[model samples]
Target: MGIGEHVGRNLVTKSKWTSVANVQYRTRRAGQPFPTAGQLSTRLITEAKRTAERSWLGEVSAVVLQQSLRDAETAYRTFFASLKGTRKGPKLGAPRFKSRKDARQSIRFTANARWNITGSGRLNLPKIGAVKVKWSRALPTAPTSVTVIKDAAGRFFASFVIDTDPAADATRMPETHCTIGIDLGLTHFAVLSTGEKIDSPRFLRRAERKLKKAQRERPASRRDRRTGPRPA
Candidate 1:
């Protein structure tokens, strides 16, 4: 996991540098500096290796670094599409540098990566040996790719995409005649199209006074911890 973190950090850092460089290059040219993802693949790979070879980054899996470049390309493509109004929904911000202090980190492993699940219920990853897996539920089918994630709570999870049969999915949810829309709001948990309203949980509102009282007494509690009780 440590090595994976190092790899992901370098990948994000290098990708951001390339994005900045691409912007600078565009300024010099007639707003047509670099080519699309396909044309720029070679250059990106060369630059990535050049940057990696200088430090501990060279130890990272080459395949993972390539995936990072692909992710960066996708980010740029999405940003451009949003700017041109080709994409739906709100406009997206340009790709920004990723920080280590961030709550989560993830790395993906494709088929090219020699990763698999062993009979012993362990995940066999490239470079990183077999790791025990805590099964929540068994996978229905083989996954095309797997993403290892480390969340803010310092827990690791492996998420994967699998192909499921449409018929099976349909069977799981029987068709219902009634249909309704819902509007979620702070005042009410949900307002249904059928005129039904679900009240919002007032737990926090009810406990506000107690919370404030606890906050007000917190300093005195700390003082009591530091000093002995006052004389009667």
Candidate 2:
């Protein structure tokens, strides 16, 4: 699963823990949001099935899935803890799965989807109410997860991970449109391709004397060695 990192602000919200607990309870009762570990295992199973079919390798077993889930949970917890004392880190909250798909290479799930929405487009979350996303680009395949990131600049962005086949026409064409050469000299700023010369304004030369005078006239202090005093 591929993991995409989006950095932005305006996607964070302030919801009380009690309210979130109520929502979780309702979602569990309704079978909306799957448990985090369950979601991870399901995704891993899908990956193993795909790998086994495509490659010479066989399908992965529950052992691999368990280990992967453990590693992921540990990483998640560590990351969450590290966010403490950070200027704009999200508060402690239960992680929610956004989607499930294999995109680039790894499987990713969107965590904190509710708190990571922006703009006015409807975000169809599992159990929580629909949120408004900024609706940038649709994923090539379905996104396994979305990570809402907030940058120091106070911007909010939603990152989606979608597995897709490599593009066939991926080569870039060489530039063949324009060829221009210019020469620069002290007398003239630039001589363009068409042989037009541009003059350079020497602003520093004009202000040199005044700047030198200002620097010279600035206050100077002398230290008396005996008293360890400064005389202005």
Candidate 3:
């Protein structure tokens, strides 16, 4: 989890630097001065190497660090593409710097990181040592990559991306004749094609107090418009 925090911080720093550089380039009256992602990564990697030797970042896997930089590049690319109207999706928000107090943090490890699950079900992370993991289910095959995550509640999770056979997946689900489409609603949570209406649960109203408290505690900048005062 500490490693994840370190990586997350590095990503935010890199993004801020990129945004600043781009703004300066746009304001410059000289010849074309555009800072590309490759240029940014090259400089970032060099700086990271120098700093890594002296700080806790030295303990983080080099592969994981590079992956974080790649994730940042991807974010910038998507942001620019959205602005240009080339990307098909909801408007992408400019990548914001992450805070240490943020509720979630994550880092990815590729095959090069040499991570694996031990016979005892412990996850072997390079530099971080072996961590005991609770298996929800057995992985069908070895995963190509794994993302370690720490959530708001301070619980850690390892998400694995495994390549599976499509034929096996098809066989597992089998052909089903009883297929139904669901129309979702507020009062009736879901109305099935067979005319069965599942009523919305009362638990939402019961949990309103806790939800309201959580929203109230959130930073102003992070709070959405939905948290505002209700209509008269």
Candidate 4:
């Protein structure tokens, strides 16, 4: 299945949890004993599996659905904590429902999901096939899990949680009292305290010049216009 479908299934699962929370709140307000968090959590999972138009849930790993629900549970827990003035920082409103129209979408896969990199370097996801990846850099250690994220700008990224040994890191790190000051400016990229000058990258200016040159070479779109129909 496509990434979009995976995200859509997650959103549907998230919405279901929100609806269940609202229902439970209403029951409590009506002077009836609402099901406890544990009860609702278990029941909701079963309900979500049998929910119509949600067979796609079975196609994806159960972790995705569970994480989305856990997210909702955490939101509500935080909201209640805020009301009681137990949660630090500013007060928070109740959790909002997830919408398909939202530009950003994400799904995380923990170690339990068994997602990993193949010998050929393709990302192998559960249910989702191996996807060709353009790795930015080499990983220092094996990632515990990966979160596939699509941002509002339509950019896709795979974020990883890498657990490294603190002792190893300390051994690798060298102790030094040396310090350097950097001054950033528009004219020059940076000036170091050691009197080193670095020229500005001017990346944007270079791209703009190339774009203008291409525009000059290409013919205008207006030239292809029919202009009230051609000569048959």
Candidate 5:
């Protein structure tokens, strides 16, 4: 978890945005005009920037604070689009206050945030400094943005947005077959149209068998403890 200039066990900026979103929602329901695009861009984010300049919020990157409002803008747009039936997916209700106990919390940073990878192969965030990471794979291109997320298990994750390389993408394509059908099942992992049945590794059953064997092969002292010392 990262909070502004520090990588720690808190999400201060996300918590603040939740409060801002909740206030906007409640006021709207109380007959106030919903925020206009002009207001979102000019007023809300501007106020946030100003607040950062004069307060502890300054520890957060200016772009990070700005991006939070951009997210709020998108949320309100999606909500109204759903209300007007223009959005394709299921209807969306008004933006709700994010729960502190939510299993996941996330914040995004754009190119303007000035984040980069250090020469020593660590993620260098604008305010939080360089952080070590285990690379899943090398990035194909320079990332345009990054999102930092904290999960309920106290693990932090960073996701990067990068442009796709057409040349590299073509290299990954498998040779084309006309078509292949695959049916997934329990006993077998999958059955393919080419008559290939991939056997499922019954890991759970294997573990259970091993556990039962361990229990049955227990020492005499363990057996004695279970049967109340053989009635003596």
Candidate 6:
């Protein structure tokens, strides 16, 4: 999901004639082993429309568009850094030109408000955009970082990281527990192991005829203004 979103957003930027980053992932063939990064890079450059290029940062840029390539790289780096391990991944590669059909959309800032929290209630983000947050339970310690993301659905969501103490359950189990078995049959809704039976209301069966009649009737339509039909 993460890599796909990055590619999709970059594709959008290329549509605006801005720069973009060319990126590729490695996959294994049916009977072949997974390809190495070098092999993937070679394939991408060979098949790409433009010659493979590199930014000052030194990465394959053959098929990348540049509008938000830098920003996307930054976001990707930030994302991996937040992961549990593998913090020292390769630096972001340079951007390259996109094919004519691949270039068509650009990124625009829409009116979206997102929030994040460091811990239980302390909000944190870049540029000191701190605010208060509400949590159902308190955190044990402060969070390492927080990020806010907005989606095309026009909804805003926040992701928070926090260190906390593990919760301990103090409830005791009861010794005198009773178990009951229930059997369901067509004649009775439920029959208990103690010989008790419960009847079924079968509401839908009782109202079947009325419901079918209502569904069969055609609903009245509004009068047509152009045709001068009178309202019923």
Best-fitting candidate, scored by lDDT: 4
**Model 4 regions more than 4 Å off:** 29-41, 181-232
Q: Model 1 TM-score?
A: 0.65
**What C-alpha lDDT do the candidate models reach, one value each?**
0.71, 0.44, 0.74, 0.80, 0.70, 0.43
- Tens digit of per-residue lDDT, candidate 6, span 71-109: 444554454355535557654443345442442323221
Candidate 1: C-alpha lDDT: 0.71
Candidate 4 structure quality by residue, lDDT tens digits, 156-176: 789889999999988888988
**TM-score of every candidate relative to the true structure:** 0.65, 0.25, 0.69, 0.74, 0.66, 0.25
Model 1 lDDT tens row, 1-232: 4645644555564555567546854674576554455445456554555764444445565566667666767777787789889999999987776666678777778989878999988888776778888999999888888888877656789998899999998888979999899999988999999999999988777778787887787765454455677634
Candidate achieving higher TM-score, 3 or 6 = 3
Instruction: Give per-residue CA lDDT, model 3, range 1-232, as digits (tens).
Output: 4555555655554555566556744675676555555565556554555774435445567677677667766776788789889999899887776666778778788999899888898998887778888889999878999998888767889999999998887887869888899999988999999999998888768678788999899877765568667444
How much is the lDDT of residue 172 in candidate 1?
80
Q: Ten residues in a row with the worst lDDT in model 1?
A: 33-42
Least well predicted 10-residue stretch by lDDT in candidate 2: 6-15
The reply for model 3, stretches above 4 Å from the true place, is: 1-42, 51-55, 89-93, 187-189, 195-232
Number of clashing pairs, model 3?
0
Clashing pairs in 5: none
Please list the residue runs of candidate 5 whose C-alpha ends up more than 4 Å from where it truly belongs after superposition: 1-33, 36-54, 172-180, 184-191, 195-232
How many clashing pairs in candidate 1?
0
Best by TM-score: 4
Q: lDDT by residue for model 5 over 31-71, one digit each (tens)?
A: 87766444554544455557744355556676766676567
The number of clashing residue pairs in model 2 is 15
Which has the higher lDDT value, candidate number 1 or candidate number 3? 3
